[model samples]
Target: MPLPPTVADLTSFDLLLSVARLGSVGRAAAAHGISQPAASSRLRQLERRLALTLLDRSPRGSTLTETGALIADWARAAVEAADALGAGISALRASRHSRLTVAASQTVAEYLLPAWLVALHAGNPGLSVTLRALNSADVADRVLSGEADVGFVEGPAVPSGLDSAVVGADRLTVIVAPGHPWSRRRRGITAAELAATPLVSREAGSGTRGALEAALGSAPAAVLELSSTTAIKHAVAAGNAPGVVSSLAIVAELAAGTLVAVPAADVPLQRRLHAVWPTGAQPAGPARDLLSIARRR
Candidate 1:
């Protein structure tokens, strides 16, 4: 059944219950943190909507009439139910505030999340955080399945059925062992040539592979499909094959001369990193805080 407009405002009903208990509109208004005139006006509006004379108002005080007392009795149950609902909502919010589950792609997990998590914990010392490092596709799956409160993904496009914001950007690097023939090349490699050549690569479903495929406009020929940037780096450094990975992951190797960056002039190697959650459901509590830290950096 549709609620009548007058009975729709729970606060007004709550005010009536207060007036019934306190025996004075002025006293009830004080309890509600409103002035006497405001309280009286609300009661008058309620009475007009219900078409009942609820209060016997006197110069000395106010008292509920028979109809008013009956209505108050019914409203009491509803008020109690509303209180329970408020309590349940508070409990859920507190739980979320104190605990967070996050799923992130390898690049974000390895190179980015440490700083973000540090800042998140700094602000929320009591918060318990769990982090899962997976490929981009798996991160999306975890978020969609409600296994994670929020997810970070590195890909050219966000997965369907998730809402996202670009928290950061990264560029893919093609690296080779110092002895590889590509290391000594004077000019940048074109996308077609890079695609035609077999390279060490991250496995399918990883953001690094997805971005490489998107940039080349076709899947690059892979000599081996390893799962981690570390594995790809080790393979490339051992002269197995050239590998494509995040520039963020290769800083130390590049500086140490173990790996050399091979420029891809025609490929769009840059990709955005996203923070994602279930569609239409905005992140709150600790999840929101972590997202803020990611974007700020």
Candidate 2:
């Protein structure tokens, strides 16, 4: 859009402000890459439109008249506002071009993604990000199929056809209510015993579920199957049954003794948490910035 007639564009006002600083109309015009005659004509037209004599023109150099000084002050404010508007629009453009989509597993989404996202925003304030929470298998699929710009998952292995970095580690922990028998045991539970016990568990295909299955070398006995980590945590805390879940998901519960972590001494339940992207298409822009932050941790 064009500026209205009363204000002859921000540049004219900018030149007005500059002449007051530069002390010479010729030098102000030179600084702005315009001829002195053009600058003089622009100021003349501005004064004519406002019906105000602004500059005290003389042979020595141009100086602001009493009214001219007040107008210059007002023009300075307009120029400052226009400069702010330009910066805001530039940020909007940056965000439009740097949009990012991220897919993460339930545990990582619930426990870890927020901090990384906050850091990403702090480092690149104009970056635009969208987040999706899915199971590890689904997160990998989305990244590999180009449905997402980046992905985070916790699993024994990264899915085929995707490149990944091991950003962190998580362990599958068997947790039970404080009143449960497992909580009272001095000895750690064996993998076979854990598999034999009926437990509350996530539905199949989640990285948390996969990690438990791999540790036991078979499917676990589940008395109830839930779709959400929060539900499973609630069910376990109610003493209905023990549940195998990520250590990351149970920090508060364990700290409060609402749920106790059972030592699965012989189970190799540790899994690598990864940041994955499409096989040959490396992450760039905001995705690259986010991945770089995760890699640092």
Residue runs of model 1 more than 4 Å from their true location after superposition = 4-7, 184-190, 278-282
Roughly what TM-score does model 1 have, to 2 decimal places?
Answer: 0.85
Which residue pairs of candidate 1 clash?
A: none
lDDT of 2 by residue, 28-91 (tens): 9999999999999988987888899989998887887889889898888789988999999999
| Each prediction's whole-model lDDT (CA) | 0.92, 0.87
Q: Where's the lowest-lDDT run of ten residues in candidate 1?
A: 3-12
Identify the candidate with maximal lDDT: 1
Off by over 4 Å in 2: 1-97
Q: TM-score of the candidate numbered 2?
A: 0.67
**lDDT at 144 for candidate 1?**
100
Q: What clash count does candidate 1 reach?
A: 0
Clash pairs, candidate 2, are none
Each prediction's RMSD over C-alphas, in Å, is 2.8, 10.4
Error of 2 at 199 (Å): 1.4
